[model samples]
Target: MMPIDRERSDADMNSLKRTKLAYSILSIVLIVIGIYLIIRPQTAMLTVCRVLGVVLMFYGIIRLLGYFSHDMYQLAFQFDLAMGIFSLVAGCIFLFRTEWIAELIPAFIGVIVLIDAVFKIQTSLDAKRFGISKWWLILILAVIAGALGAMLLVIPLKVVEFVMVLIGINLVIDGVLNFWVVHDTVRMIDSL
Candidate 1:
């Protein structure tokens, strides 16, 4: 009984609805993680920083060995040699002075996150200029982001662990939401 144009419009609405739901779920997860990081940053900071250092050291060592060895893989060897040595040095630094280095981790991450949020808010505002309905959402998000940034800059050592935990939570949430989209889309297509 429905007109062809009405059917098309309905289909478009369904698609948009699905997309928005998925995005909202992912955003909620990320916000939860951000909250966690705000609460418990020190432990997260140390663990992440140490792991990163070790990985770097491993790559550096491989690079250095490859250059001196007979394998001569050329590009890979050179890359490995450089990375291996640098990683080893970095790993040592992290291993020995985790306490000192960990303090910087939270602040560094906060700055990066704050910058990213600002960019996102700018984009959201731009969208609003095109007559989008959620201009207030961007303002709220920006305020939260700015507050978190200030916290990080003021308290690095105390914040790293919390930040790490929060970031981990966000990633897991994002991954789950993305996986859910694949599920919902499959279900929708099956129904059709």
Candidate 2:
């Protein structure tokens, strides 16, 4: 029994080490890709656009099929059907207009960011009402995000370089944060 337990412990240790190694590699790779994307914004944006187009088309088809397969209320299906059509059209437009998609990518991202910031601001407001400490921090970050998004939307071309730089900074931070994850995992494994 003692021998068997020892063997099991050794195996677990080995597995944990391998997992740690894998995570470190993944984090490094992501950091590299992020840096590359920052350096070559246009190229990265184009690749992203193509992928988005394919995803949109795939989801659109699924949506259409699901709506047609079940006889739902015409009123509900009408909205769903319209959304599906819109998705399909947008996807096709992306697939065919790669350059155009690239040009519009910043604005699209900006819109998403702006929406996210608004949601964050709302959450912070609720937090403030609840007497949560540092709600203002969230509000501040939200405001910054909204400002950056607005810049992207209003002057995409001008903001393109800034966006790329921000992406690079985020990636670097992500990579650094991943190191913390690895450290925690290692500590947990030791505890186990």
TM-score of each predicted structure versus truth: 0.41, 0.44
- Candidate 1 residues lying further than 4 Å off, grouped into runs, are 1-44, 50-101, 156-192
True-vs-predicted CA distance for residue 26, candidate 2, Å: 15
What TM value does model 1 have? 0.41
lDDT of 2: 0.56
Tell me the whole-model lDDT of each prediction, alpha carbons only: 0.48, 0.56
For residues 86-175, could you state the per-residue lDDT of candidate 2 as single tens digits?
Answer: 668877877899898787866765664565456556656665665556667667766776776666677646566666655444444444
The lDDT leader among the candidates is 2
lDDT tens readout by residue for model 1, 1-192: 569977866675465445435444544544555455546555355666666456445434433543444221122122334444554776677767887867665565455446545644554555455454555555455556656665656663544355566454433333333233222222232244
lDDT of 1 at 156: 35
> For model 1, what is the C-alpha lDDT against the true structure?
0.48
lDDT of 1 at 103: 60
